[model samples]
Target: MLADSSSSLAHGHKGRTGLVRILFATRHSLAGLRAAYTGENAFRQEIWAASVMLPLALWLGQGWVEKALLMGAVLLVLIVELLNSAIEATVDRVSMELHELSKRAKDLASAAVFLSLVLCGGVWLAALWHRFVPG
Candidate 1:
């Protein structure tokens, strides 16, 4: 039975092929977004930040490349945050006890999120300086 299940998994039996797989993937992605938004306070705050930054990215950017860079930087934060939240959730699901490995994993994920935020801030500041400052 284990072999059968493993073989089925190897063959992509979870969502099958073609349109069914695409639909299932889309559904799962939406569910993940919903779960993150509803369950994660940090995610909710980032969503609000993105809501403001995305439009500002469009308006403040001087050209297509600037716009893309600004927008991508903002989105990158949310992506990193989602991954960080997923790691924390998985670690907690495994065990709520104070384990060094789990703590390390969560901390590393958090650092990734912090780096993404730094990158986003740098991009935005550069753009703002370019637009407003007399340099």
Candidate 2:
């Protein structure tokens, strides 16, 4: 039974396929996005920041590479935040009781979000510096 199920998944034969799979995947992704936005303050804040930064990226960026990098950095924050939120949600769902391992998991996820924010800030700062200061 395990072999059959594994093989089915490996072959993409046990579930939705083709356009149907794509549609389902897209729906699921949208639901996740909605959930993050509704339930997570950090995610909502980052999303709002992205809403502003993305347009600024297009305007301030000197070229395609700069624009892509600037936009990518902002998006990275959102991605990391979403992952962190998922981890936190799963930990909470498992047990509300205080546990050392649970604390570690939440702390690690928070650290990941912080690092992503730092990277995004660095990228934006570099772009601003390059735009305003000539060497």
- Among all windows of 10 consecutive residues in model 2, the one with the lowest summed lDDT is 1-10
- Model 1, span 33-72: residue lDDT tens: 9999999999999999999999999999999999999999
Q: Can you give the lDDT of residue 67 in candidate 2?
A: 99
**Model 2 TM-score on a 0 to 1 scale:** 0.89
Global Cα lDDT for candidate 1: 0.96
Off by over 4 Å in 2: 1-14
User: For residues 1-135, what per-residue lDDT tens digits would candidate 2 score against the true structure?
Assistant: 257777888886557788989888899899999999999988998999999999999998999999999999999999999999999999999999999999999999999999999999999999999999989
Cα-based lDDT for every prediction: 0.96, 0.93
Candidate 1 residue runs with Cα over 4 Å from true position: 1-15
